[model samples]
Target: MYDLGDIVEMKKAHPCGVNRWEITRMGADIKIKCTGCGHVVMMPRREFNKKLKKVLESKADQA
Candidate 1:
């Protein structure tokens, strides 16, 4: 599961050419910010799960 401040990779790279994203918000909908262009996107949790490739960096790992 992705948490706030976690870095993740998506199945598809964003138009900016980066697959890295940071989890900024979570709840019924999760929000992620693109690391390449600072773009933010909000999607349903189910959709997010479907698109998520893997967690690159977890909150626990940051500690």
Candidate 2:
């Protein structure tokens, strides 16, 4: 499971050529901000779970 502020790697790279995203919002729908071009998107929890390849950095890893 991922929490807000966690860094995640998507299974596929975005149009901006980035696969790293930061979780900014949570709940029924999760919001992710691209680390490359600062693009943001909101997707349902189910879809997010499927697209999420792995958690690069977890909330616990932060300061």
Candidate 3:
């Protein structure tokens, strides 16, 4: 499972050739920032779920 501030990998690489993203906001829509290019993207929770591959790092774990 992913939560705010978690680093995650997506099923497909981004156009920037990076698959890792950082969760920035969460709600009905989730906002993610590209780790490679620093580009931000917002998508519906359902869509995010479908594209999400795995959680790389969790905020809770860091705390």
Look at candidate 2 and give me any clashing residue pairs.
none
Which of candidates 2 and 3 reaches a greater TM-score?
A: 3
TM-score of every model?
Answer: 0.95, 0.93, 0.95
- Which numbered prediction scores highest in lDDT against the true structure? 3
Cα error, residue 34 of model 1, in Å, equals 0.2
lDDT of each: 0.94, 0.94, 0.96
Q: Over the stretch 1-63, how does candidate 2's per-residue lDDT look in tens digits?
A: 789999999999999898999999999999999999999999999999999899999988766
**Candidate 3 RMSD to the correct structure:** 0.6
Q: Against the correct fold, how does model 1 do in TM-score?
A: 0.95
Q: Candidate 1: where is the Cα deviation over 4 Å? A: none
- The alpha-carbon deviation from the true structure for residue 59 of candidate 1, after best TM-score superposition, in angstroms, is 1.7
lDDT of 3 by residue, 2-50 (tens): 9999999999999999999999999999999999999999999999999
Model 1 agreement with the true structure over 1-63: per-residue lDDT tens digits = 778999999999999899999999999999999999999999999999999999999998779
The parts of candidate 3 lying over 4 Å away from their true place are none
Candidate 1 lDDT score at position 35: 94
